[model samples]
Target: MAAANYFESKCFLFFLLASLVVDGIVAAAAVPKQQRLDRISSLPGQPPVAFSQFSGYVTVDETHGRALFYWLIEATSVAEKKPLVLWLNGGPGCSSVAYGASEEIGPFRINKTGSSLYLNKYSWNTEANILFLESPSGVGFSYTNTSSDLKDSGDNRTAQDALIFLIRWMSRFPAYKHREFYIAGESYAGHYVPQLAKKIHYYNKAHSNPIINLRGFMVGNAVTDNYYDSIGTVTYWWSHSMISDKTYKSIMKDCNFTEEKSSARCDDAVSYAINHEFGDIDQYSIYTPSCLALTNGSRQHMRVKNALLHRRVSGYDPCTENYAERYYNRPDVQKAMHANTTGIPYKWTACSDVLIKNWKDSENSMLPIYKELIAAGQRIWVFSGDTDSVVPVTATRFSLGHLNLHIKTPWYPWYSGNQVGGWTEVYEGLTFATVRGAGHEVPLYQPRRAFIIFRSFLKGEKLPKSKRISLQLSFN
Candidate 1:
């Protein structure tokens, strides 16, 4: 009897081991090794770090050979448990890798000489998995087989291609399937972020079980309504003393904010604002020093062109983009990043002038979309850097005031590290905050404070309202 019992036990153990092996095999097969193939072992001049990073192209349109480039910086600790954040930089043509990753919120800061990278201690990845995508076909390392695609890119196509990229990317990195997700961007991405969110929202509704679990979105110093943005911008210039009162009045009187193109008188007035009123200062961050090294002619267009930049290649960078251009163009950097594999004709540029000049379509207003999403209970947040004259806090406030939502928490000073970081107000369906003394690129100027607000956003908590409480999180 004892021998028979022992034989049965041995058989059970054998079956258990076999089942485990089969399960492992099935799991491995289900998740592709493409993600592993795209992993970065180390970047040139990169310091040792504990986090994992992956970068490569996701082909969106096979016939056109159109692909979007993405860089995933996993969270510093317990990354799988943290939510994923998709970040975009707008110029309709800027590279997120240049602005978002290298300067604003990414893990590394390029040294002055572009020879090496140092860790960004206050990187957003500490709170969430940050995915930086260079969207449309012609931006950054992203490319297209057809030349026409670059010149013909528009708002609609940009949104559609981004959705496609995410669908395929999630499949390639199957671990991220159905993970809590959020979209965030600055400047023109006011349009991209919301439009993409709208697509994701409706797509999920159409399908029984969607792969992306999108929770909310955030935009900073965004371009919302052309009319409101224009009006508010001119007002900001005069109010902030960036332009003379005479120039301001001429712009206000002559420019029809509602029109697609400003009248000749308006253009001339605006030109005068650029040529005569403003000096050799960085218009984006009025209080900051301009990058004297990158200065050519006086920059024109305060709104949305190459002159108009969510493009962080200028202003208070201290010649940061010059360094970034050098670093990214290096052969070693490209190889390590798995970027510029095809060796496209042009060098890697921060913003593609071709796409910017010939952009096919744009939405005049995003207020309606904001209403729709807010009604659907989407968590929406808008923040501004008070020092950014380009898309100043005043411009955002004017645009958002049109929403007419009930104020949940009245405006109050929010504290970070025993100092007033900024002011914030919570609304029925949205939240608005400002960063004190920060510029167009908030993190580049005020990283620790940026982290605090970001952490609060992820947790669905309000910014700390008191210095005593702020002191607790100051060490972060």
Candidate 2:
């Protein structure tokens, strides 16, 4: 009788254990119902990773069938606990996937042949869940059924659509509905980030309780004030010796900084600088080599493709945009990533020429938006890559100078490793920093330092003031 009872208990224990295992598996496979269709199991040539990735379109306008595309790379560890970061690339027409994801901060960097993928050691996903958005209707895989939408794209519509994307996207991934969120981008994104932040700020205010918990925003080498950017860019060209003194003088005299549009003479002078004086050097990163595949005797490249200026050299691949273009256009890759299901006519390009040419409305200055958000006690950080001549550090400095915010923490050298990472100044409602030796895309040029800056920005902490290892956090 005793032996029989013991056998019964052991059998019961085994059954209970087996039931638990089955339950765990079921739960593990259970994804949000709305997100199930867009979940990416894996990408072609993507190395194995513990974290899951999701990419697909979110329809912002049902009437026009305008949908924006987003790729969400969950945090490396504890994604649920980490903050969600929305990254936008500014071309007024550029694909964030091509510039931000494949090249700058995303986890994967396309190989030279564009046939394989490799991990970016300094990917921003290491610290936060990074969401790369192909914003507006006409950039990358994001599209609009209404042909007029492309020609009508502007700052107002882009911000509205992006807000809608986030609202609907949060519903799809309810896990991140109330998570601390941030907006980040570079170049033209300088305009996008703050404008979107202002929208979210007001949106949250009107609602009693909002799902979008926007913490702050950061922009690198941003186009802040049109007046400052124009003047500052011309100054950068001459100061860096990229243009002759005569050309600089010509731009200053011909360009009316106060006007919404430049004079034809100003345009002529600027063109002369690009054509006669600038040579073939990459204006984005004056020090980096231009992508020969795109630049060699291509007038279209000189005019359209130069908007994003995606280039890198030395330790990084110079033809990253080409690789991204090839990899993203692959049928298998698109199918796996669940992109272009509508069979769009155009081949994927980095920046959309149609949208760029048709950009109808752009705010002359984001200073008013900055002041509004700052008054609301929003966290605002502006950073710049020192080596970029197009939207140079000087341009950002000139724009921010218009803010005239009181400094809290005086300028100081912030350390990443043994060397100085960059210099930072804490303001009453904002922070400004510069990444040393960094180009147009700071993360692509100095990933480690950029990551450090990112972490600091997120935590609302000043960068480490010392070289001592104890002061700085270890990052992968």
Candidate 3:
């Protein structure tokens, strides 16, 4: 009789376990497809495409009603097998939608007219599932009900909010929850990528079933160390004949680039170098012409200067920012993307002027975070566009010097096709490379080369070296 009772108990436990498993499956299946918000349909003016595109908001702060806008473009082919890449643009306030997606490496480029779109032959989406996010509360279509969320934005808060967004985003798109993921960005995203990666690493350690499969991160012409970046900028300007020797000397002698507040003498020197010396040229891409020519009339000078400073680099159009601004603000475009759902008070912009002015916190150095992440066995790649003076390759090189990492691969030229593309070096924990003539926006200046390097990054392979034509070997 006791044996019979034990068998019955085993059967009951087995049935309960099966029932729970069945319930879990049912619950997962019950998630409504409509709730997935897989885009109300395709966007108009978009070039014919095979991959799916989805755009919507993911609420990060319920109390403040803060939500982030995202545009996810699936890979052109075999998207289910490709890794997912989250691309952020750092102004601490820039719209990834406007810059990263529409103007740089996204699947489509806004036409010069701003009302049409063109296929980007070298879109990063061809290599991976690309996700562009407009972060914080005030940038692009992302917003918050509580006005303070805009003014209170900082590096830490932004990173935390982005982390929350990623978690919730994964919940909505469960297919990508366990997929390999990478975070990449440029300029100030040097802060955003590392901080968010650190948060994910911490969360993975604390949780039993980690959803985010964060594999690595990359930053381009990033502002990693402010002091190094400042010094490098001044030195680069001087070396490149963009500033007077006297100005350079004065800046070096009086400026403590590491300080939060610059000395008056330093400020004066920098102003002379940038304003008087560089003049009306685009500071971001010193080699590129300004979107609008500097007018001789003093009345138009300030406006021209602002336009130069704010313009995005596009090989095809210098006025890409103007085009993007018009494209995003259109009611039809917003409706198609399912953006501005609550009728936010302000129009969408490429960069948030208010957030930039009110930015509360910025770290001088992200090297320590890089060190921690590297030691934790995360892949790290730092690439620079050789021609970008704003955050020059010199700045990146100098900053990496602070890590004192052991050299794994000595610096060598990498090739794209039969021509030299850039120089690359591998350290014990990090890799550094330069896109030969590319500017602040690498993909904008050299999309094909950028795609090649990007593919190498994802594959954990060294960039290709020049091959003999007789061999008929191609890197791609």
Candidate 4:
């Protein structure tokens, strides 16, 4: 497969010339691997942790070029017979390694000293084999000489390149070929993951073989439907008491809620909401307050300026704190991430980029993909972290509401630690879960809850029942 020349240019190629130098490299011994291991082992009911680490470059011919970069992470357990999860982080041009590897599901996290690995007690590798990829030929360590390569990074081109990457990747890890594969990611990946999954499905039908035997996928507070995603942001602010009802209502009435134009009213609505909701506004945490609480400092570490700090080499971090500044102010990080900065109209901390990007303004919604998958007998699950304002549960419900999935089971709370923190419902082969007190990143925010959901997913079991509440929703 040859690289497609969708968005590359000599000028853009020059833009890609930036190089990454490891900053604040720490000695390996200083990291407390044993501390984390001991803590993890002691955790009650924690799954046993294990992994097969692999790192290599995948070359794919796309954008009239060969794309190459280091791929890292552990495969699923050989004993578990679980699915293969290919995870990505969305910047359209962000480092999956920075967010996907360090912050979220991958097994190892770089210590505050920036040297050595610390075992994340709640790493998602427990449920399935996971792979983290740096993509688009210029993001992170991925490189290219052709400046034009940058121009070729539209949704379709990226999806195509990703498929090529997958095919070649499987050749190196052949045991995973037959594994139930799933593509999961966050942020702009709401677009990337689904489109790639759809393409994989399309090719399988065309080739008459299940090379990409996709089972199901989940996106944590991801962006899918633009209108609802935009409108829901305002409503989430109001619900959280971040904005006054009057302010929210006015914005709801005046703002178009379309992704087409960036509006002042929309921006004001969010700002107004943020100012009224919390005290000590300058230091508020962006993700759920719980995540930032543990960090015990405003910066993730002293070297880290703010949680959302975007630097060329420092990498893409989903803000657990300082979400506002991270999204809007970080210049070097945005450039390195290959962000389509032209799409952005105003200063935004979280969703400003997508709001201004070259999005598909089509009347046709995403349900067709869902309908096709369900009709083809594929299982699909849509889960959300309830507290996330970026791609809030309300938007997910609004997007799914258009589908009007017939309720096979009523909505009920699902459990972890004898407490009800998530809601679950099954409809046909699809299930929807909303985890409480969680934000944009579900696994990072609530690993135990994520594990419970994942366990039921692999076993094809119904949603777990909460002891304190009824298992079924009373729709009547």
Q: Would you list the C-alpha lDDT of every candidate in the order shown?
A: 0.86, 0.85, 0.82, 0.58
Q: What is the TM-score of each predicted model, taking all chains together?
A: 0.93, 0.93, 0.89, 0.70
Model 3, 106-185: lDDT tens per residue?
A: 98888767778889888999889999999887999999999988887988989999999999888878888889999999
Candidate with top lDDT is: 1
Point out where model 2 deviates above 4 Å: 1-30, 296-315, 469-471
RMSDs, each prediction?
3.2, 2.9, 7.6, 16.1
Q: Go through the candidates in order and give the clash count of each.
A: 0, 0, 0, 23
1 or 4, greater by TM-score: 1
Ranking by lDDT: 1, 2, 3, 4
Task: Write down the TM-score for model 4.
Answer: 0.70
- lDDT per residue as tens, model 1, 1-476: 99999999999999999999999999878767888779999999999999999999999999999999999999999999999999998877878998899998999989988899999888999889999999878988899989999889989999999999999999999889899999999988889999999999999999999999999999988988887888888888899888987888888898887777767898788778876778776767778877766635422232442134322234345578777788999999999889888888899877777887788899988999999999998999999989887778888999999999999999999998878999999999999999998888788778888888888889898999998887776564
- Residue 425 C-alpha lDDT in model 3: 95
**Candidates 2 and 4 compared by lDDT, better number:** 2
Better of 3 and 4 by lDDT: 3
Candidate 4 stretches with Cα past 4 Å from truth are 1-50, 66-72, 263-365, 467-476
